[model samples]
Structure formats: structure tokens, C-alpha cells
Target: MARSGKDTDKRIKTGRGRTASQIRWLERQLNDPYVKQAKADRYRSRAAYKLIELDEKFGLLQNASRVVDLGIAPGGWAQVVRKKRPKAGIVGIDLLEVEPIEGVTILQMDFMDDAAPDALTEALDGPPDLVLSDMAANTVGHKQTDHLRTMGLVETAVDFAVQTLEPGGAFVAKVLAGGTDNELLKLLKANFTSVKHAKPPASRKGSSEWYVVAKGFKGRD
Candidate 1:
């Protein structure tokens, strides 16, 4: 079993078939405090703490009645929502399968599909008060290409939030280090009363991930 405390460094032997990068990842996981906390708290992944921390700072779940979670694989962020707001209706979509969560409706499909937006709205009783997207494109190792691909997902997510969110609703999505590009920033500012960026403490210091939080949806008038 892997332990996740930082009290002592854990070293793994260079076993056959294990690459150096894999070993480094394993060691890092072993030492991650949030991973240990997630295990103890029975949350799905260390990613749960990221949402928890964001919620603490932004109160994202405080008044949320209906929520849509994009890229909900491994079900960490959805788990946090469930714990924080048990009565909030949640619908999650991802390309990967997620284990059944007690109150969440999980959809295994590509969010890029034209059918996805309608399917998600139909699952909920009303317009979502919160829309969260942790989606990122699979990296092809080329920096510019990877950034563009991920930004494409972010843009789509923003469009969905704008089209479906209730007035006063909020949208939160993961973005790269430089934060949202200028055009996306302009779009968000035009449709939302407040827009800001943050990097939650649970995110690794070396990670390029930042979150853009847009609140007070101005409606699609």
C-alpha cells in the first residue's frame, strides 16, 4: 500500500518495465499530503481538495442548486460537490468512465459532441447555478499545440455556461499558466459581472494550471 505523508521520503527500487518518469510520479504521489487526506476522507482523488480549496475561497457551492461538471473522470470534483451540497442536482460528463456516485448522474460521452449540451440540460430540473469544467485536451507534447487544444475546451465550456447558466450563476474552469487568453477574457467579462483567476493551493506549485472564476451571469439577452 502507498502512504501519502511528507514525514519521510519514500523511494522505490528501479523495477523492470518501470520508466524513470513513472517512478518519479509514484514517489510524488506517495509524498502528497492531499492524497493521504483524500484517502482518509474517502474522497475520490487528490483533485477533490482542489475543489474544496476553491470552494472555501470562492463559495462556489454555497447557493448552487444545479451543477454541471465537465471532465468528471475519477469523480473527484463531483464528490466534493456532493459532500458540500447534498441536495444540489449534479450532472457530469467525460470521455472516461466514472464509478457510480450516489447522487450524481454520470454521462460517458464526449462533451464536444453536439448532443452533449442538450443531454446535460435535460438531466437537470432547471438551469444550473454552477457550471464547473476541469477539462483539458490530451497533450501532444508540443507546447503551443497543447495550449491551443486545452483552450479550445475551455472556450466550449464558457459557451455552455453562458448559454445555460441561471442569472447569478457562476462558472469555474481550469486554464493554463497564463490564464485565459484575451478574447476569452473579454467574452467572460462581457457576460459576467465578476471574472478573476486563481491557482488553488492544492494544485502543485510546478503545475501550470490556474482557474478562471466568472460569477453573476448577465443572461443571454
Candidate 2:
């Protein structure tokens, strides 16, 4: 494969006490444009560009007042939300401890915890106008198991969004290769006026991840 001009000739030296996989990861990170851009922008991770691209296409952050971020470790997505919606009340939950960001609330806990939903809403002080889930299960190296676990996170995120999003609000979640399954797709379509899948430009070409953007919440019956 031909390397892009942006990659230059940067290469990692082998035998640095790093395993082959770790060395490959480091080299890819070194050559990734998004990583460079993230450093320049002072965002926490390259994943921030995924949200930025999604927002540019979906307008997810423009009118948001209260927002919830699921799996907000490293605080990249939350940082983007704070930058774009400066006044939006942002609360995030994750099993990983995150360094705090100004104008954002960080909760170190599992979102699957029974108390999570209440804690998130309480922190926001209102139903969120936008809910973003970047959560992915820790991969177990078994493809089927990994996909199922990640989808479980997506399912929970969708349930929370449907239960608490303000009318006409939006929900965005990371889904795997097949996107939402039939039942989850039906639930999203039934609850929101628009449900679509997108792979933002920032997403790596080899990745199976996609974003489900559901907008115009129809409100509870």
C-alpha cells in the first residue's frame, strides 16, 4: 500500500522493548493526521474529530442546552461539546477516570450501573437535548463477542436517550459493522423522526464502526 504524503517517512524503530502490535499502533498514531490535528487543536484524542465531523453533518450540537456523554474517558468528545456549545450543561460517565474539563461534569462509574441514568440527569439538571455515546466494550479478541458487547452498550444508550431526551432532541451512538439490529432499529425509528447511520470521514477506512444519528425525538406517549 502506498503511504500518503502526510505520512512522510516516519517509521518506528523495532526492538525498543515494545511488542509488534504496540509498535504498529505507535507508528499508525505517529502518521495519523487526526492525531496531529488533535494536538494542534489541544483536544484530548483523535476521536474528537469523529464528533466534529458528525456535528458538521448532523448539527447535533448547535441547539443543544443539556448534553450527556457516555464513555467520556480522555474527554475528547466532551471537549468538543464544550467548545461548540459553550453554555450547554455537559455530564459524562465512564468506568475510566477522566481529567476534568471546564464547564463539564465527569462521573467515574459504569453507565450500566442502575443508578447511572438518574445520576446523569441529576447532574445536568434537565433532560438532555443531546446524548452522545462513544462507548465500546473492551475487546475480548473474539469478534462476535466483541460486537455483541459493544451493541449492548449501544442498546442501553438508546434506551436512556429515548427515556430522557427532550422533545425534538437528538441521540448519536457508535455502532458496529451491521449497525443497529432490527429490534433496536425499530425502537429508534419509532421514537425519533429521523434515524440514520453515518461513518464520519474521521473514522478509519478499516474500522467497522458507524454512528447512528437519531434526531427529532417524538416524546413519550
Candidate 3:
């Protein structure tokens, strides 16, 4: 592949049996500034910057006492939380095994399991003031199927947040580009004082992901 006139661009040589898609992915990763920054900062993944940007814009981590991280794989978001709010109780659940992060309680289990919510709450001393969900269903290639599955996870995360968050709390979850569906948007608006969607600069321009941030949790009436 030819460089687009950038002297610093890194190129990946495609070896035997490597698909074009794999080569493109590697090339993009090699050229991504965030990926380089992540290595320099010792963060687990580039996704950490997405949360950092969101926190800067929303003030989500300030004075947070308890937090729940849904789909906290590779522990990047958890690491950010530990750094920003060192004394906060943080519990994370994911199907993938995450190497231990000090001050974070990791549960290597599916967040959709019926018992998962209870386990998360038990790990914390009080209701979570900040609930973060980066969960997205594994893509199955079909666009509609992938979108539906991801939205299902977001809806469930919203339900969990409504049922578990403390008053004046905040919930942040990744939603697709078209933003939350009408029903989900209604639910969030009804339950939160402010609901807005944002795509941080850290998110790739080609990606369709946007984050739905709902703040000021209304207590269960």
C-alpha cells in the first residue's frame, strides 16, 4: 500500500495467508495516533481516551463513591476510574477475563446473567453514583442483526442503571450512530434530568458508535 504523503506513516507488510482486511486493520492500528499515545501512557487500550474525553466533558467521575462498569473487558475503563477516583469502589463484569486491576473488583461472567446485578451491587458498599457501560454485542456480519444485538445490550444496561443508580447519579453507555431508538430515548428522558448523545474525538470517524449520557437519576417512584 502506498503512503498518503505522510513521512511518519507506518506500513504493514502483508505476509502469506494474511487477509486484506487483516492487513488494513494492522496498517490502521500502526498509523493511529491514539494507539501510540496509549502505549506511551501505559493504558491497556486506546478506548481509555474515549472515557477520558467523556469524563472531561461531563464531569462524570467527580466525587463518585461507587461505580459499576458493564462489559469492562481488558480493564481499560476500570483503570481510568481507579486513576481518577482512587478511593471509589469499582466493580466490573465481563465475559472475558480481565487481568486484575488494583482497587477494582472483577467478575469474569456474563453481565446478562440474572444474578449479575446482585453480585455487582454486593461488591459495592452503596448504590453506584456512576454507571458506565461500554458493552456492545459481538458483530455477526449482518448489519441489522449487529445493530439490534448491540441495542439490546444498551437497553438492558439502561434498565439496570434505572433500578440501581443513586439519586443525582449519572449513566453513560455506548449507543449506535442513529442514537438510541425512540423507545429507549423516551425511557431515558423520563428517568433522567438530562439525556444527550456524544461522540468523543477518540472515537474513530469511520465508527458508528455514539455515547448516550444520562444524568441526574430519578429515584424509583
Q: Which stretches in model 3 have alpha-carbon errors above 4 Å?
A: 1-7
TM-score of 2: 0.96
- lDDT for model 2: 0.93
Q: Which ten residues in a row have the lowest lDDT in candidate 1?
A: 1-10
Q: Which regions of candidate 2 are displaced past 4 Å?
A: 1-7
Give the alpha carbon lDDT tens digit for every residue of 9-72 in model 1: 7788665789888988999998788888889999889999888888988899999989999999
RMSD of 2: 2.4
Question: Model 1, which residues run further than 4 Å from truth?
Answer: 1-6
Judged by whole-model lDDT over C-alpha atoms, candidate 1 comes out at 0.93
Q: Would you list the clashing residue pairs of candidate 1?
A: none
Q: Estimate each model's TM-score.
A: 0.96, 0.96, 0.96
